[model samples]
Target: MSGKNVPFQDLFVTMTKVAKDAVPIGGLVLIPPKNEHQLLFVLGGTAKVQVDHKHSQPILAADTHFIIKPGQSLQITNQGSHLLDISIIACEVVQLSRADHKLSAASVKTFAYFQYETVSHTPRSLRAMVQKLQEPSTFIDMQKLLENQFLFQKLIYLLMDSHASQTDADPRHAVESTIEYLKLHYDEAITIEDLAGIAQLSRRWYTTLFKEITGENPSDYLIRLRIDKAKELLTMSKESLYAIARKVGFEDEHYFSRRFKQKVGVSPRFYLHNRRILGTTVTHPELMYLLGTIPIAAFSPDQEFPSYLLEAFKQVPKLNNSHHFDPEYFKPFKPDVILAAEWKDYENYDALSRIAPTFLLPSHNDWRDELTDVGEILDKKKQAHRFIRWYDDKRDEVREQLKLLTNNETVAYARMTQEGLIVFGNQSSRGKILYTELGLIPPEKSLLHIDGKILSVEQLAGLGADHIILQIGEQADSSREALLQQPGWRKLMTSPTSRIYTVGHREWYNFSFSPLSTGFAMQHMLQMFERGVVR
Candidate 1:
């Protein structure tokens, strides 16, 4: 009787029942083995179906249909966020002889069951049939029994057709089908060769086509998908890291951590701590450095850094030529939080916020206020306050020293660029350090704007300052040398009361209002004024 398929005409439906049940979140439904075969169709939500307490598959609404054989127990757990609605159809079948128009008692076997494969897309009529079967019938007449028999046979035929269509599908269609399967079963241990076989393609060709289509190899794509799910569970659930690792298809937690870091730029523990910070602007990195934590990555539009920070940030990866709010570029290095300055042109805030907790500091906020906000986000308010205090003390000390060395002498900061001479105003970071913090006065004709303003050499000379701190740009070295050959520059160089000091452009221009760069800029200024040279 085992594994025997009775002819359609010989099969008779003795009894049939339709049961509709709703399982709440975290609810469980167990159906013990009975003498009838059962068809389970998910009406809504998701359920983890376990057959015979061994085989398990996640069934989603309208996507899959399951059959439970007689003597096989079924277990369903609500795995989705909402209620799980499912319809179960149980029916008893026995062989009947049409010759005598009688049921064959000897052919009634308890272990006999239909060998139907699970179908992903059940027939549209199947649901309607199940609903009709649910209609009230106070008396079981011969006509009602014959109608049930006809419907049951139609369902068996639909299941058979679905299995045949899938098995006989074109190779290309099979590959597409396999890709859908991969998305649903990424947590399962799947191998490349197994996927290729499902796609009915050679492994090499399958991998090549997969990469060409998806921009990643099959294995890498699968791992990235798994990692994305792992990230969701890590942040949304209280599951342990080990449990998460196993749930996401990784057998070892250490291996999971290594892969996570490779993909996300931080270990799982660091991610859980919310320490994998990504700085979308130069200022955020400087502030994070002052907070005693290095960002996982920092945006460097020009691939440049201050001389003082070059060594400390030598190992940090630089994000070059990236849009201000490009979330796709930042997705691979899955940071715990993203720090960005509010930009007038920023339009993709939602995209970045989807990747991590994004903190957009006001663009008009002072560096101190920005640091306070960042500190709060990273849970390092104490460090932020301490650094602010230390900066204030240092500024006071530097101001007194400057006043003593050059009493009321006007000092100016300028940078030599390929375009022309650019001077900093009181609003700039370097300008704030010298004119605001250290009490040094800027030349009267210098640009007083928030950023560098280009000026002619004559306009710079017109300011008539006693001292000038000039930063030499990378492409302006020849310009600097050529400027030195000018008569006006030589006059200032040899002047008894006037002096000019040169520093690297990278060091000067990268300095922001953040404490780390601000403090470094202050030390550089003091070194120039005391030693008459930039060290």
Candidate 2:
């Protein structure tokens, strides 16, 4: 089986399953298991453990022993300065499985390699031993196994006994040991002392080792772990922010906000609403589903959502990765009836027609009737009719529940508009793109965070704004050219006065959806705008 398939519960595979002093950060470990496991001997210098907190004491030498039989857990920490060598090893848990069980768990000794070096590059003695292990009969000979075990034991003993003599030694072992403890007990309040005990070393030694091995203080790593968990939750759950904060070991939402902002560059709410802050006029459940998954992915060059739909239809778990922009992102799956605004997009997903019919959704919205016409093309005119009824039900529910929030009889739909980037629709939610794929900031009155200094009419024209909305007009420049360039008299036109005020306003300012809705309207309006049937 692939490593990705393995469900890891608090355990990370070690790069080196068997290692020596490697490097110590001033701590020794003594893992007192609740169950029995193999008998393990930790040999190193001064160490501190957390069985008793508020202390960082010295560790005993090779003479100290802890039986790590099957189903048992062990810990050792060594805190020293210069490369203090500490030795750690795992023995067969079968030998001590049920006897006074004190270890954590008993399972197959699954090891992982983060990195490794060739035996030829090892010390002279280790090189010779490795070469011997490669001999043709090594696997068949029982004596060779015994000899190999004995040699490994001797090597660990030598590294621990003599190499771990300095106060500040290599701290990789201590760092790794702490990582192990953190992985196991993230849900609990863990401290340096607890980690020290795991490594059979002193608190000071453990802290030092943690830094040496991980290149950061232990506390920093813990925060990172918490932040990562928070991110996963934000994307997957509809949990309240306070609840999520508490779940991630943050009791205060405000503090969590600060930390999350510092780490992720966005607030929790933004991450959650990035793709889904939508207000729709459609109320029918089936219609809502159809519209939400509009299959308008005709030009989604990434091919992402199509494949995702294919897998979803097949009940496969989402296979997304951190690289969200990968080009082949959506090639893995296929979909039926892709809502194409353009024929080009239809061709893009045409490769999957053998699997299912990929048709386009009708793209007209001058009034609501076009929706039915669009559905009719898919041979689902009745479905479109039913949608309006479903929409009414949802609209009534919203009006009943959220009536106090607004004074208007017609509900206002707010969401990021594609043209205005972060703009929200001010009119009704029905019959338009209620949302786009952009994060929406909740409506709150505050000074615009845009440029502070007001630009004059001439300055506005220089900046190339289609038109300008004048708060008040005051002239600073006397030049006629400058006055002419000023936009103070310009009309910032919108849909209400679109055609009526054509002389003073620009045509593009008549708000509408993307080429999608506009093109749809154009197709339907062709006869009205230019008499007769046209494709």
Candidate 3:
């Protein structure tokens, strides 16, 4: 009860009981007070224990222990995924007079309450003794009762030894205490040596253990905490950069700017404006560019840009290779914002966010909606709406021309790749322009919803369309020649009722998805219809 050690003759233990409990995930265990003290040991898993329904403290497996006083209620919760296993030893303790070695009647009657203390990292021998108490026993037998009393005495001795060896306790407790201190005083002027001294560990050992537990060295962790606080201030308040720098523990604004850029990939001023944008998808860069701002870097898997945007993006650095974005490769660019499409690797979002504020855009069937969302991110809502209106007006102009040119004829769009011939659906880039915008009918209703499907020669022969627009790939000339030699190709070409038009695969594939590219695709399709180059 007191910090001082109780003499061996000054205490008596009786009615000792040991119970083991298993609490499942998200389960709660309540231990009612029976006018007896308890020694709670976490055998496995972790638990949050609250005394009398007050604030709780975490008890880690095999590393912490609590001595609950008599008449104290306990509320234990298992917040982790696994079962929380704990052993509670309850016993009645009577005070004895130290001088005469006899029970103190007055002390027993008064039962003065004392402060409760936690004893961490008890000796290993105490675990075996507690486990022994869990064995089946007949309490009515006097021998068993005496055995329990003797075991309790040994347990008390082990507890005393734990208290005596406080200086040699687990270093984790000291390190954890230091971590709490750092969290509370992050903005204060603190040194690594001071933290190590507070943790009672050598500087090297302290840093090693800190990194092991927190995944960051002390300096980095502290700096990150300060930077996070600075970000909040920057967003919520109009504090001068120098004032913010001083408030978040940096003495110089220049040093703060450098650290902020290193951690956040942008200066404070750039963060507010989000000026230097990075695009993680091909469409994202085009959308941003159409919104009147060129991305600092963009994904260029083949080191090629859309023909319509090539001149504008000729100076932008490529951020990805073969459609794969490496966060390390783009760190030096220091973008203020990153626009990523949902099709990119979901796992890299966190890493990308660390470099800059990253927004993951979901796949939208309509490129206009994607542009509007990007506009919201860059605060260019008006530009996005204006572009959509321009596209709609252009689409209307083309749709009227196609109404007279095609005269209700069915049209199918296809692309020739090295693999084979693939047809596009109404929802696809080129397909949308042909079917939705220009109001062309597909040979079958199923093609209206199909995104993209590969067709064998047999399937191609059965496709009953008035006209077919085939885009030829750069390296698929041989494949195209082979297809032309097939019987299905000959039959389709010979049909006087059907017409076939050809276009460049590079021009159509790259310039068919984003707002700007879709506009180009419309003009390209109209030109092909006017030229009427049947194959």
- The local distance difference test score of each candidate is 0.71, 0.38, 0.73
The best-first sequence of candidates by lDDT reads 3, 1, 2
Estimate the lDDT of model 3. 0.73
What TM-score fits each model? Answer: 0.49, 0.28, 0.59
Clashes by residue pair, model 1: none
Superior candidate under lDDT, 2 versus 3: 3
Task: Provide the lowest-lDDT 10-residue window in model 2.
Answer: 112-121
Q: Runs in model 3 with CA error above 4 Å?
A: 1-197, 200-267, 301-303, 319-326, 427-433, 473-478, 510-512
The lDDT, on a scale of 0 to 1, for candidate 1 is 0.71
The best candidate by TM-score is 3
What digit string (tens of lDDT, one per residue) describes model 2 on residues 269-355? 774443221111111111323434332122221123232234432332233222223323334443322233332333333333333
Greater-TM-score candidate between 2 and 3: 3
Candidate 2 Cα errors over 4 Å, as ranges: 1-174, 180-185, 200-209, 212-215, 251-258, 261-535
Steric collisions counted per model: 0, 93, 0
Tens digit of per-residue lDDT, candidate 1, span 1-535: 3223343445554447778889999899999888888878886778888766554564656546777777777889999998988888887766544654322211221111244435466667567766676655545576876787677666665655565476545555445555665665577777888777655589998887777667889889998988887876765566899999999889999999999999988888777766578877767787888887888888653556666667888988887744434467889997866776678324455567778766677775368888888877766788898888888898899889888777788898888888878788887766776777778877783355656788776677777878887878756778877887888777666666667777765555555556665667777777778876331
What RMSD does each model have against the real structure? 17.6, 21.9, 13.9
